[model samples]
Target chain A: MKKLINRQPGRVGQWALGLLPFVLLIIAYLIASDARLAANANDKLLPALNSFADAIQRMAFEPSKRSGDYLLWVDTLASLQRLAMGVGISALMALAVGIANGTIPYIRATLSPLVTGLSLVPPMAMLPVLFIIFGLGELAKVMLIIIGITPFLIRDLQQRALEIPREQIIKMQTLGANSWQIITRLVWPQLMPRLIGAVRLSLGPAWLFLIAAEAIAATEGLGYRIFLVRRYLAMDVILPYVVWITLLAFAIDFMLSRYSRWRYPWFHQQGH
Target chain B: MAIIEMKNLWKEYGDQVVLERLNARVEEGEFVTVVGASGCGKTTFLKLLLGTEQPSRGEMLLDGAPLPAEPDESRGIVFQRYSVLSHLTALQNVMLGGELQNSRWLGHCVGKTRKALQKEARAMLDSVGLGQAMDKYPHELSGGMQQRLALAQALIKKPRILLLDEPFGALDPGIRADMHQLVLSLWKSQKLTVFMITHDINEGFYLGTRLWVFDKPRLDPQAPGAYGARITYDLPVGNCEKNTLTRINRSVGNTSRAINDTL
Candidate 1:
């Protein structure tokens, strides 16, 4: 919560600041729309504002739900499932492959140049090639995302693993811990914070790719629905679809970052 | 066996030599304290004995064999810092060394092995006067308590040789003296061969059966910084009051004064 102001005048000033932008926009709109609406006040704004408020309220209530009719839509179970499975599996694979690259010096040396070379190859250019290999499928979508995401995961986690305290390494060595024990007990546990951040960042790109993936060849999902609307120029459907995607993205980030905080409470002990 | 011996040891970094042509020995079940002023290679010298660092020009023998790649069950080290795994309880930290000696396969075969390790760890903690602190993390404990935990962690394996690197440097004065007494008692009770580093002259003078000083031997004749990093004091440990003890103190004082005035 915000620190509430003490004095009534001071409180009013702060609240006025909060309302300023919306107030200014409304005032401008009312002045313009008033002339258009002189015959009837409800003709200018009430229906649109009421519908907008309803959409927002619907979103606020069942945040975990993706639902229908309102502009704030992730508004369906199927769309949420596709996102959860797609992003969840891809991010997890990225973490595993990336951690391996970062931890094993030899593997990193072997894989990095190839990855760097491949990264330069445009992802869209591979779409035709992937269609032949994967046969118009989910495999192509998930794989495309995995490729897009693994490098970031590998780089961030590698950096995090590298930054583990030197003293701890020495202590583990003195404790007679073998290399595997050190990585499993020390390195992986420390990777939780950076891993969560990596997952958060990758979620945005994953969603972007999901829409692209679904836009290509899907049937039932949000992207497919948006594509159907695009054929008819139904801005209502397309705009609401985008609004819901953004809402879902915000929810995804909030939940994972919350989990990151819970799992690694000592993360704030760092300089940040 | 002398347990540890350094023969004509030469440790160097590039063109600068740290410990040059130095011969040292440590007997089984004895306490030796090495002390020196700043930059005296006191730490590097101990690292060689601890098997953390290798002597560039010579070899060290432990228990009649060449030094192992890792310091073995026969030797344990207490570093200058707590070096206790912060995530582990004090008891867990103490139990860590002994646990390392147990094979994971064996533990898997036998159920409830942690309870056994916990019991042994508790015994070691009791000896270090930290039995009550067994459940706390190193960060939750004071520096003195942490060192005591480190001491237990080091000695729990019942290693024949114990190496401590300025273990009391971070403790308050009162804690330092109390820890010093604890170290003395533990050494006497266990009949443990101990090697320690100390900056406090009184500490070195009191704890060591014999004291060695480290000074950089490469200090330039005309320049200030080129002096040897450490100088050894191969004298016996004693207090100030007795006749023999007083004589030894005067000799140590004179030698220290002479080194101060000269190099």
Candidate 2:
């Protein structure tokens, strides 16, 4: 008989194993909710599954009385817009800074220390400062997300560009590539997949900053609604919102990785 | 006139000398194979020719003019690994040299020019026996195939000087033999002035028209960096006797063992 560590799961067995924990968690939640509701029908801490469905239906299907808009879709749209602007701007900035710092000695000498210093400063500590300057609006929320993730992405990409083998750079030189040619031709293409990878890694922190900013200032956002309903301990609404955010993050990460694998097949061929 | 001339060339880093008092003249279309102990300056010598490293003192002349401080279209090089760009396909890798030279700003060519380049690159790849693998990436190719792709890439530029730094050092013996034939045919067809560094003596003799041995003539027990390697032997190949071959083999073997023992 094979030992437990030596044994490998078949495809079907692996799928069953992956779902086991989720299945068990749902069962436990049902039991706990039933017990809580049986003891007190007015319980709100662990709302029943039916109540969760009702809350989602109200937020997603029905229009809000005040704004006449579907609240769930509206909030999702607002949150996604902020996220896109912040991440898109950071990706562009990171590409410029990473390539310049990685390939050019003069730029690296001028900015490497500055980038290192900025990366070390706690981004959350800048929340109040951002609110004060950008004001309590979408710009502040988006700025917070950018501030939180850009430094990390820049450093990651800069290190990636530096990791390009010296032999390749010399080979390019021998082939008559000027400095600009090396950057545009060799470094740029090589760094694309890496940039996507860094962006994927930074998504979690970007979401954290986005939600924190929205909770503090925004009038309409997933995070804003969760905090808005929290005064009444609206776990029914809060739980669903949290789950939706998780699904969105997972979808974005999955798509980015798939896009990288599809668009840069050569980059993925070496298992990197 | 000699295509390349070196007079009392020296290379040093801080207090350590790497190569010293080297003099050589290579004519058009000569294949120079360099062999030495591991720590010797054979690679340093190649770098000087490739224009990656400038001599700390002394001069190197190409076509009776100073060698370019930076590598240019006149030179092409292949290394033991990573000679081919991983991101580009076999055809794209071969076209890159011409593209960079022609398209100054874009680093890639446009419609008509690109089509013409593609045709030429395809022919170059076919010449290197990689016609079926033109669309393949470096990672998709085997070690020998990647080296072939690299050779195609370097030769497409029609460079005057082709520098190869142990380009087949990592291949299996069977694959290496195939590469040797491919390289010799390319050399003759292109009329290229070649410089190759190799650890294997038999390979050096078989592939090179002329052979150079780099060795340190003076070594002090207290100061190893005080002296540097020099071109201790310069011999013509093809007419060598077995007696001379054995002598060179024994000396190279002893030098390698001595260097390895110290490490």
Maximum-lDDT candidate: 2
Q: Across residues A1-272, which tens digit of lDDT does each residue of candidate 2 receive?
A: 98999999999999999999999999999999999999999999999989999999999999998999999999999999999999999999999999999999899999989899999888889999998998998889998888889889888989999999988998998888999999999999999999999999999999999998889898999999999999999999999999999999999999999999999999988988
Residue A7 accuracy (lDDT) in model 1: 36
lDDT of 2 by residue, B145-207 (tens): 999998899988889999999999999999999999999999999999999999888898898
State the DockQ, from 0 to 1, for candidate 1. 0.25
**What is candidate 2's TM-score for chain B alone?**
0.96
* Tens digit of per-residue lDDT, candidate 1, span B157-178: 7778888888889878898889
State residue A39's C-alpha deviation in candidate 2, in Å. Answer: 1.3
Proportion of native contacts present in model 2: 0.85
The alpha-carbon deviation from the true structure for residue A108 of candidate 2, after best TM-score superposition, in angstroms, is 0.6
How many clashes does each candidate structure show, in the order listed?
A: 25, 0
Location of the lowest summed lDDT over 10 successive residues in candidate 1 chain B: B103-112
Structural similarity of chain A in candidate 2, as TM-score = 0.98
Model 2 chain A lowest lDDT segment of ten: A137-146
Docking class of 1: acceptable
**Can you give the DockQ of every candidate in the order shown?**
0.25, 0.84
